[model samples]
Target: MTNEPIIPTRKLLLVCGCLLGLTALTVVAYYVDLGVFHTPVALGIAGVKAVLILLYFMQLRYSSGMTRAVIIVGLLWLGLLLAGTMDDALTRGWLNVGAP
Candidate 1:
């Protein structure tokens, strides 16, 4: 008795196409300078790609609620770590400490 979810070929192909298109868009975004908006644009596109891959390739869409919860929690933890790192890096020069 197999418990695996069967995904349709058409849906998989569609997702593949979307991922490829997003990759191309990323390349295009890299060349065009948006100044301050560039980083946000790139990160946004990458986030979309990551979500698509997570849902489709990782089969998260077919996973149980508990499984999804775990994945969400893991992502939240990762975000927290990244936020902490960014905070430290950004605030490094705020207070001047003596160098010995």
Candidate 2:
């Protein structure tokens, strides 16, 4: 598939909508107390934003095979990195992560 926009008009609108939605979501998430699930909710939202960026803005949805493979590889590396970091942070920190 060519890299040309399949629906330039709609894609542009979707990108804008995603951005605005993310902004609104972040604002609302900040105000909404999630108690024990706060971090999970925030992370879930952030992951959604990342997927939107990769699938739409990055145009991976219409990308070449090699490009898609590269993106998948990069995401796998990122997951490994985040997992390692989280393991270290959680194991090391004595700080209060949850709300009172």
The lDDT of each candidate is 0.90, 0.80
Could you tell me which 10 consecutive residues in candidate 1 have the lowest summed lDDT? 91-100
Which number leads on lDDT? Answer: 1
Q: How much does candidate 2 score in TM-score?
A: 0.69
Go through the candidates in order and give the C-alpha RMSD of each one to the true structure: 2.4, 5.7
In model 2, the Cα lDDT at residue 6 comes to: 74
- Candidate 2 Cα misplacement greater than 4 A, ranges: 1-5, 85-100
| Cα lDDT of model 2 by residue, 1-100, tens digit | 6656574878768887987898789779978888998888888888888888887877777778998888789889999999998887776646666523
The clash count for each model shown is 0, 0
The regions of model 1 sitting more than 4 angstroms off are 2-4, 98-100
lDDT of 1 by residue, 1-100 (tens): 5586888989889999999999999999999989999999999999999999989988888888999899889999999999998888777777855322
TM-score list, all predictions: 0.84, 0.69
Candidate 1 local lDDT, residue 49: 97
